[model samples]
Target: MLFSLITMAIVGKLLHNKGYEIEKLIPFVLIAGLVAYFIPIGAIIIWPFKVLFGIIGGILGFVGGIFGSTIGGIGGITGGVVGGIGGLIGGVLSVVFGIIGVILGIIGIAIGLAFGLVGLVLGLVFLFFIPATILFVVIKVLHSETKIAPDRR
Candidate 1:
């Protein structure tokens, strides 16, 4: 599953760098990942190389991004090389960050749920006492005319 996700991300990035819209390809990638999951033999075969190649790919991609950015400054082939490497790095980082975000989101939900009743009670108090009272005061102030004492200069 990890291998497939990583591979799909890499492929998606590569294609995106080539100017293909990744959104359109997401379904296909998902389908491919599903197909890959069903095939255990392939996963077993790629497991050993997955880590080794991922590191190598990342190192090479970093070098390529630097090189491409330098060349990209001049225009032309820069887009292809630089974009691909940038996309490669971006894809991997996105997946990593996405996972982290999900984890944090889960933890956040648990925390929020734990304190939910407290929050609701506090919110009701504020709503009824603070904002509602403030709004009433504001409306009264706005609508009521102030009586000024006659000037007795």
Candidate 2:
């Protein structure tokens, strides 16, 4: 799990530096790692390496997002099942509501993805603007040279 998280973070940073927006991939990688950890199938052989590949693959352009989204869909299914089971208590209505909650959670996740994309764009814009503003102020101050000077020559 720790390795998976670290790998995802590194890949995410690398992809971001390479002009790729792969923020959506993180959750997918996380889910895959969790499944690998829990499931005793042949995942033992492929899981670690797949995790590595996923991390690296997701560091690029739309590719990472695509892979991540795919994995995330799988994860969503598992999550829905787990969430529904966990919430299945307190009567029949609770189970029904739990199913509804699971569906809502999936919808919420989709909404979050949209918001994440928007936030990424806004954050990039802010990154450029904030630095430019700071630089402009610094340049103006330097040009004016209005600060008090030292007494020494």
Instruction: Find the candidate with the highest lDDT and give its number.
Output: 1
lDDT for each residue of candidate 1 in 1-153, tens digit (9 for 90 to 100): 876786677767777778878677787678767766676756688888998999999999999999998787768666778899999999999999999999999999999987998899899998798988899988997788985457855
Against the reference, the lDDT scores of all candidates come to 0.83, 0.77
* Per-model root-mean-square deviation over C-alphas: 34.6, 43.2
**Candidate 1, which segments miss by more than 4 Å at Cα?**
1-75, 117-153
Per residue, candidate 2 scores C-alpha lDDT tens digits across 59-81 of: 77577688889999999999999
Considering summed lDDT, which 10 consecutive residues are worst modelled in model 1?
Answer: 34-43
After superposition, candidate 2 runs with Cα above 4 Å error: 1-90, 129-153
lDDT of 2: 0.77
lDDT of 1 at 32: 65
Each prediction's TM-score versus the true structure: 0.28, 0.26
Q: How many residue pairs clash in each candidate?
A: 0, 0
